[model samples]
Target: MPGIGPSIAAHLDEIFKTGKSRHFEAVMKGLPKAMFDLMEIPGIGAKRAYRLTKELKIGSVAELEKAVKEGRIAKLEGFGEESQAEILKSIEDTKAKSKEKRHLLPYAEDIAHEIIEWMKREKLVARVDPLGSLRRKASTVGDIDLSAATKNPAKVIEHFTKYPNKKRVLEKGTRTASITLPSGVQVDLMVETPDAYGALLQHFTGSKHHNIALRNYALKKGLSLSDYGIKKKGTEDYLKFKDEESFYRFIGMDYIPPELREDTGEIEAAIDHKLPKLVELEDIKADLQIHSSFDIETSHDLGESSMEEIIQKASNLGYEYIAFTEHNPSRSKHNDQQIIDILKRKREVVDKINYELQNRSAHLRETSARHSEKIDQINYSLINMNKKNIQKARPQATGALATVGRVFNSLEIDIMPDGRLPVPEDGMKTLDFALISIHGSFRLSKDKMTERVLKAFDHPKVKIFAHPTGRKLGHREGVELDWPKIFDFCKKNNKWLEINADPMRLDLPDVLVREAVKLGVKLTLGTDSHHKDSMENMNYGVSVARRGWAGKDNIVNTRSLVEFLELLKG
Candidate 1:
């Protein structure tokens, strides 16, 4: 404060008043606005935008597009043919995305989770529930809303105002608070008493239409609903609940999951006791698509663990099986024969590990039997002597041995532009399964893309489709295709589709997943993991499946190894 100047003090005051920095605008006045606008293009960073405007005299995207089309951008010092083409593609992608609404699902979920966790750590908070579209697991969220049950509302409000990531506090009060995060997304919090917390959560965690429908139903039952509680038609006495299950049951219906409370016949289904038992995270028994260090070379295909490490981790998670679907070597820097040989060796290694695990399990069984016999003899001696001071012999515990989970050798093969398999038939035969995927050429026409995918499905060896849509969140749009036809084809062909669990690519998204389930097509959940720790992303895929209303019966990986193998045989 000693060195504080009038200009700096004025800047700070302006920011506090207007929630924006006036000084930044004053500084940017020296540069052309077009230079800043050009920075919005995907591949054009600040430096590149400045260079384009200063050196090439290109101040607009249209002019940059013209330059790219005329081969002029390729002539620039730092730009090459590939960079120019990519820039053009980025321009097109930006234009396309501008017309779409909603932020990516994962981005919004992360921000909400961070805030909820921070709130839960406060001693005064009894419970914190993320509400609204986020709770429903929508593919994109408009804003974040959270409800908390706490008797000390004043303390909760103070804690929220002091959140480390807060850019600015919009409003603060004893019962409600609002703040804007650094990411420019606004978050609202409501604090209520424990007696009315369930009703408060239900009222706020709703689609507007769903809430309206529920209110109408309540009116018909001579009841009134509010955030605080439910009341009779002519009385102020509120019937409160501590949990959603009791709240729904009091209304003469089974509890509805947040994901299914979209006013899409779920209310009727609940009343009739016919709601599907939705798939849960614990229902998943395997990760059918994963990558490890055994895969071939690629800048983006870097893996942090070996096949054995992956198996151990999967086993620790109580999985009965896992598949090592490494990127096909044809896309890597390896020759076909070399890649095939490498896969064969990896298969042998996995088989040997499985054999050792089987032997260890057998040994444990034998050891347990001998221990039981000794304990029985000691008990008989104690009984015969009628001794009260007999010492009990304890059975020795087994050490931390790896679980006997089977590891299958598989490949994430590319679906060629013309819809043929990238790997040869002989190479495919050596693998346990083939995960077909479309890595590039995403701008193909809808009919062409659909036909291309259909042709790939025609291959007898291709058992599963990975990240079927090929969409990268906040970046690229997936190729267009007739999804119903694709779903029908998968159902008829006895093939499976993947719920790719990469945070950026939760493809075969919720809506498509629902359609696939209705068509009776089996689904597999894969983390599409590249690193050892990434296998944990299986939860995200499960969330997507739940949002789609998928049940355990619809997922292939939920089956045991023997059941899964039988399904694969079809």
Candidate 2:
């Protein structure tokens, strides 16, 4: 946003509004999708990638590497053997660097899904599961690992080799196999009998430190651990477990959740039966951050879907409520009075929609009760026989207490450089609550940033701090802040922190979430969704919460409307 000029902004606005821009079309005239990926290679620019792809049909780095090895690039115009050698060096450098980097959790999950779903179709495979950091739901993962349960290990291995998206089969054996995806990420698979599957999963799923700690704990009991099973120190015989619960039970501990298997004192907690009931996706009842197409003339991007459309999507997801926390009206363009007027207008619209949803749900419930009563009065025996059908005849309501669409007219207002909120007191009062965030001046010293955030929290309506760390997973680091002080302030002042569910910013990262949970701080989950469909990202937030060992009690969004309003009052 800082580097963008007026012309660039105009171009973007045009594309957003109409999906077409003459200048953009001219710039992208003859390029194929592959050229974009090719440009990502270390030394290749757009012009070079375009020429190479068009001239030699080298659509990927792998293909380009092949051409370079074949001496084909040296023969091309303006490229001699020396230039070819330089390109080869760059390619090698890139390959080595990529291998050291980890893929994002969603990307790894998708790759695992392809493998597990494919293996499930094999007749010999009874159960398949992901293993390693993937099972722990880490933010990023290295190469994928999975395991399958089957008596016919050889057949399962054979079936794995025939996977459709596999670029190459690295290895194949009677009980194991490995493959490389076309994307160059490797996938490893293991096969085990049903009786031994639990041992395999537990062995592979825990982190290296977790495994060592668990093994050492078992060694104290004169037991040795292995993928096959646990065995006595002096005995060759191994005792098999049919499931993970049994595996942990035999070791005299409760089953440690996969997310908590990070050697983070989880083993000790499990032994004492003190492990928290980790939060699940089902515990989520609201998506606190949403943007609807109710325009208030903000400088930032507007929502692409209407509030009605978002409510309908939330209904399908079974949410009790959602907050439309759009960016506050552009400060430069609107007067204080204008901003207040716009916010008041938006609140009225939310109230009108809530009225309709409440009335509709009530009418349906009343009608359902009447129908059930008539069925009973008509014939007692028939009513007994058709009770389930009578309940089915009634339309199902989306909310927990016979209501839905309890919209929160919230604003994601920016925390100004000097620690002031952009919105005036009157405009702020219109919001059910305000969520403050720092969008710029990320270079502030730790004390300044801390003071800046604390000043924003002084406002009574500012109930949550959105994307507190402001980190973009692979692109940029977050601003400097005194997190201990920040967490302490929130805990004492009854302010909530946000876990932004956007893939780019799972902010208030897992480590911080864990700290917040430990310090008695409450956190909320929001998709930061610009469109209705992005609401589904709430699951990723729940994943972060669970990884932090948060229970349902720690997440504010898990609260119903009544309970959430009570917190706001406090």
Candidate 3:
């Protein structure tokens, strides 16, 4: 709709009705479909696709790979050894991954920020936004989708094609352009006028089913929806909006958060004015899954960051509290008494840190009083008003939250195959509380796995279940468990579930998180950070919580230290 002039539009009605124009067959008569597949490989574009097929009889990816391996491709003019090697590596990479491979959200964010900043400076671009899965905060995303608000579509497309590190421009058109990054990740950009920006965002930020259901609902209301704007059913008139909130309000419902637009009863909730005030990163006051470099000799990876370094970083983040939930000392390496001694030593170190924290408390409060900024990172409705603001909300420090009053001395204990904790009871006594999790034996049956976890929760000090699902994205599926029973146990026994914030393990995923929310099971956020730099991952955890429809009240770590302490005592 954006680049369609009246003259070109007049010829597209029949094409739209039948999916293609009659000239399509004539235009594609001699083209090999395999060339399209080859073009998907990073090192191959349209010209290369044609050259490889024409000269080497390379049609499919397999045939191309064979030709490459046999040194047939390097012999071609305008191709060299370096080019051949690059193409071979790209083919090998394509072979290694599943067809549905998606980049993790953080990785995609890095690329989007760099590219979006580039696009924003273009004179023709009035605004830029991420669309679809990235906008919805999905844990993993496919192609990075972007939209530009502009008065000049053609100029924006030309500028976008010139992105500095792009491997090739896949397609260039009047309304849209696609380019592949060096990593083979595709980025798609669309141009639209500022007045219809909201319509464009809502139309494409879809989780297919959400849009389908929305269209059905609109049809019943004698209205039609499109990227251009809302249309009256029997007339050609359209109503345009510049923001998503206004767009939803015009439809007689509360604005649905992008994270909740997954056809998961969000439409019904919006109509009833029951959409959640979802949790925000600023509401969080603690990071509960930190590991310290203080070595008690762990069974797994030891932390690379020291407790003092982590505290400094946490203070910089405006946190009021944090925990040192390092892995329990290896049971095989240390007997029960040895484990007790190690844990007691850790407790002593934590006590010293807490003592220093108390000494700094008065100064911390004074500093906070001096700086009025609340560090409003991840503010609600992170849409049009400010794109750059959402990424880096504030650099000013709020000292009141600095040097959290005390560092909770905690341990992430591994649950043995038989449901026994690796940490002895005497050792656990030195901790504020413990987080138990399944590190192995993930192949156990659903009923048995649930039983094992419940048994682990039986320990009075085992207050939270860490990374409850035990999933490693892109590698391992989470262990199976009976959720109804698990939720009941946590709700009734005051046990908490953790949403691990690590990019590789965003466990207790959004779907389970929503279920836990319904059953009133409290959840906590943990970055599982071994390095201080990883502490920033807490934002990703908050994203998962928001996606699950969790509000500030549902997340335990959102509480003030006093509130969290009271709950622990309860």
Candidate 4:
């Protein structure tokens, strides 16, 4: 307690004075509190808010709006037309009441998939499909829209209304119903006959702009489009399809995936049949970042599952490799030597598993070869005994046996406020891989923050920048930096950026991902998972990559363990 310091003592003293932090109040005096509130908008961070207040004389949302409308904000440095538009949109979104009701993509998808599976099990529907932004894999969804093809609409509607999780029924009808789930998520269901399901699916699973563009395209083709079907311009006859593929084929275009149906040249790409092969969940061969109990007691530590459990889970997922990038112990109570010992133990476990796996594989191969040689001897003897018996004596070789996955010892090292790594270079050299990250000190200026990150990239042992932007959905904006410069540095250094797939922190958001891809910056998809079930969130990262038009080659973990190691060496 002797070294408790003035700040802590002041905080304790102020607890009795006003039951709050006097330190925080003093800090708040440096800038208008309203500017802090303005920073809550999606596109505005602390730096931008400070700039708006000091440079533009805007201290509140209203003043920001006024500045935007008067065309004054666009004249400021770094405030272009696009920035102004985004700020205005963010301001509007901040003020909008319904914006708070939107759910994160993974949460919405889970609920939607559960309802679809439940309805399928109940036998009340032949097919059920979630539509709208949820199906499009948007980062957040407003409402869950579903379309069902069923012979009995009334029964399906009744069952939906009576579903166990339903908090309330907004409306009920024979063919349609809306219900609010327990989590305050609203779901709307439309039941149609099998003949019209495709049309409904295509119509409802849309970004409005995409649909309008499709309609215009149809008109040019002398066809009329609707939720019912495609109809000839001067006739009542309509073309119906059983699936989206045929529906798109009818329009003389290739099928566009829901994720790419954003009216962002996807329609034109479909017509040209030139869409890039999007990366898939199966294309991912490993998870590059994960935490275990070894990572406990650190900031943002998700230390639930043990290292063995994580390895088992990765093996079960059929992953060829996984890196246990535990939090570096430099920031914790452990000394460097203790951390090194722990890592040594982890490596021993991994080595034992690998040794056993190799031995088993070798034994299987030897047994297979011995059997094959025996079969060959039998065939030879049969041929000598009688030519007709050779076919019976011959035996085919069994397929190669499966092997256990490889586990690597890695660490998620912190980039300190001054751009130095928390772990020493000696400690870092022992890691199979190092994922450098920013844990705090998010208020650095853009230039300073960019320099800090670029310095971290200069570390010879650092292989990846984990959750590079550090943004958390709906909570905080990431540190401001010149991302184009960062991307170029990464490309030149052969360093990787992580598409962290945690629902709250899908860092390297899609737009940045597209930019990174264009810069030839290699990407690694990490669930940043702390538990077994969270490993499945890898698909979220894959979704982000797909939205950015990244192919399998753009990702690093798609390679086998040997290939990945070789690439790391380069």
Candidate 5:
């Protein structure tokens, strides 16, 4: 067997010597790195971890201590009742210190920005600045510190007290006030002269770690840092630094980026300016799949697929096109022939609307002939304007009206006893957009289930694999086929994955969606609505897509209908 790491080997050695070992490594591998570290201690495994985490609500080692002290472990599953008191007794036997402090400064930058903007607007602040841990860009901020060049901070402090959405006033004095926002953000206002503002900001922004490192480095160079100034210890005179950058330069360190001010080797990296650029939400475009009450059971109102309604709902969502993927014909009991006939009728309706609008010039002339001279002159003027304007306006109004017409159009279907009928296949492939989904036999093993879905993907007509996991919230866990493998196969085959928009079934969770995107798997947003009303779920799918960090390029549904058809060809 390969030698394990020192930590695991030592753990195994201790467990084996203590005669309290079973499936330790197996449990460790399944947990997250942070969670794994917590589980490595004696008496911690899948059962205990689950018990402590789920029932006792024990997250970190500190929480575990509380659970043990409270004797809550015995209440968890797989733990015997007698083990509860023993666990608490054991926790009492251990010695560990709990450090309680505000985790990070809260809303430091927002406070800084608000205060600076206010100072600039009010003219009381000659020169206002944000300093302290916020300027260092620490990951966690606890409070905001503002240094403004003002003769009187009374007005600024008073403004803060009267500020909208103020939650709590922590401290108040003539020149300073600390208050919490409704959002739990805390800010401290400090009034100072322009000459001392930089020193005050530098003092406030000190990361205790960075400060200590700087102090130790400075001490070696015969200097000390304080609110007054950086001064040589032996000499009372100041170091005479002009700005924050010069202060760091005098101390032999490069300027650090605010986001990296955690003293996590960021100071050293700042020497070389090696900060990695992080991607923001603005980089994303397009949300792939979503649904609208298109599923038969989900759209229980009519026991039928509402394509027109779906289209109108999609239009309302600002979507140019949407995949009207109903439940697969194989799973649905509805007559396929009837579905095809209905689609044919829908196509005719679309054609009629298109034809009426296409010949609107002639239609308008005819309709205008029946009106008075005033109406005739108005009609002639409208028609004679610009062809481009007429073309643009006609399509826009017709598209909206066409969508409304579809929403009101209803068709009924009764599935025969045989449960085998041909769904209408509209030969008019003008829409050229559809997604396929599975609706039966979810309780299968991974290999069998994956193979079943693979067949659906192999079908040329299936553009997207809808609700891949089929996990329904607060209900069934759904079949567990390996998602990485599924997403990989889909990427290789140019198939899109549906982020099913149902709140209960945001099937492709954000994490999985991110992984799928990394593998270049195209995503399709589907409301998966069975009825017109449920089509609102497209927004839900879009939200999930945004959560997944999906941009427009990664989404199949964001493309033109022509592009969608071309992608389906793949």
Candidate 6:
């Protein structure tokens, strides 16, 4: 706690004041206890320990070795002069203390979300955005700031005090409040009215260095700018800005997004404002491939989805399409009939829905024309039609209902096995979508792995690669991706990459994903879900995509149903 006075106290305040205390576990998990102990050494101070921990990731004796092997400890300022001898001596000195650490990002994310949600509800702040190093997507973050635009200041203070079920309010002020939460996440809630919110949000979201640069820039213009507002350096002629965009305009800068708010050259970039549009979640059109309960042997499920359920879930998700890329019969516990039956049953259900929906259209149109207010009501009832009634009515209304809106515009199969892709006798014009996957090649050499994947991409009928790395969470490192070569081939061949959404296998981490994007690779995220429950995993993939800075155009699924089909056809 020695080095933890104001800054550490503030960080602790964040944990205790907000529900996000759990996020710190990962950060602490990555730190060594011995590093804390080292701070207490006779000559060592918290600054030195902070420096050592920052550079070496040293917590105990073992990490000392790791830091040395990683060439981090030797690179520190004073240590660099006699790095060879001093680093070794430092390791020997701390060798007695040791512990293990892990990936701390999850914990940080959890805490960040807590503060975010808290700010939204308590502060009445709309459109709160993350800023600073965390926004930059760094592997680690020291502390976090939440910037929110609110109409009222007193409400902001009240909300922060109430939420995370705060244990105690250590300090309270109009703009800022310090409090402790039950979980030990110390937090500070800073509030600004909507008038000053945008500019302040931009400033607060930046690193100290970035803030300094902006300040210096303002000074050069004979203007003084702070998180509150901007005004002439000598006069109180501070032009009160109404929003973030106006703030940028006042300073002759383009609006800076949260991600690039780091202390780097973002200020200059904002001035030039030539930032490329970042990819967003709405851009995806189709989830080309996913699993079902049928492919349970190699996958997690033993049975496939009831055809009706799968289509309904896809519809609910606003997906124009979804593919059932079940395991091939040759390699799995399924028989040909089982696979056939699943498809057969799915088609039957879809046909039945389409038939009923068609029949209801004429009546729906007549009702809506006479009673325009009843349109949505009529459509809702039509959509709520059950399978039993639809099936029963199919024969009676088959002819009339043929004009109804189709319940399913897109539905397809995903076939996966070891042999060459299934192509039509006519060649290259067979299936709606063909997704290839890697299931058993986790241990192959890099070249062999690369060769197999390259072959799959070259196959004309193969539309997308599923779970490209075959990595499972908390279990295995994926097939080591030879990205430089693989991405090169994908770019040239026009192959799409899958950011598998299975929680255990978010294979294409944002780092590799960004690299793929830089090389002009179109990325796709598939739930690869064995159950309907898993379809929600796409959100996680989106998170990874957001971290990678993907844009809608970069993702294939954000297209419309028609466009998606065309993509498959191409």
> Which number leads on TM-score?
2
**Model with the higher lDDT, candidate 1 or 4:** 1
- Winner on TM-score (1 vs 3): 3
Worst 10 residues of 1 by lDDT: 396-405
| lDDT (10s digit) by residue, model 1, range 178-276 | 776666577889989887898999989997778888888888999888888899888989999887887888888899899888787778888899998
Candidate models: Cα lDDT each: 0.82, 0.87, 0.88, 0.82, 0.55, 0.61
Which runs of model 5 end up more than 4 angstroms from their true locations?
1-313, 328-433, 530-539
| Candidate 5 lDDT trough over 10 residues, lowest sum | 405-414
How high is each candidate's TM-score? 0.76, 0.81, 0.80, 0.75, 0.41, 0.58
Per-residue lDDT tens digits for candidate 5, residues 1-570, read 387888878778879798655667676565544343335445566656664565555555556666656656665666666776655555444321111112232334556677667667656667776666556433234556676666557776676666565555556677677665555455677765555555556666776776676677678878888755688777887654435676777766676534344455556655566533422223222223333333333212332434444554555555544434433333254455645554555556656654553475365455444544555566567778743444211212333432221111222211222222223435224233444454556667787777666765654444567776778755657676778778878877787787877667776776677778668898876555656666654555655565455667777756665575577676
What value of lDDT does candidate 1 attain over all alpha carbons? 0.82
Candidate 1: residue 549 lDDT (0-100):
80
Instruction: Please estimate how well model 5 matches the true structure, expressed as its whole-model Cα lDDT.
Output: 0.55
What are the candidates' C-alpha RMSDs?
13.2, 9.6, 15.0, 15.0, 19.2, 13.6
The local lDDT score (0 to 100) that residue 326 gets in candidate 3 is 88
Q: Give the runs in model 3 whose Cα sits over 4 Å from its true position.
A: 1-99, 363-397
Q: Can you write out model 3's per-residue Cα lDDT over 147-210, one digit (the tens) per residue?
A: 9999999999999999998866667789999887778787889889888889998999998999
lDDT per residue as tens, model 6, 264-319 = 55578678976547665555545555555532333333435754566567656656
Off by over 4 Å in 6: 1-145, 148-159, 167-175, 178-186, 207-242, 260-273, 300-305, 327-432, 437-448, 467-479, 501-507, 533-549
The true-versus-predicted C-alpha distance at residue 440 of model 3, in Å, is 0.7
Give the lDDT of residue 13 in candidate 6: 81
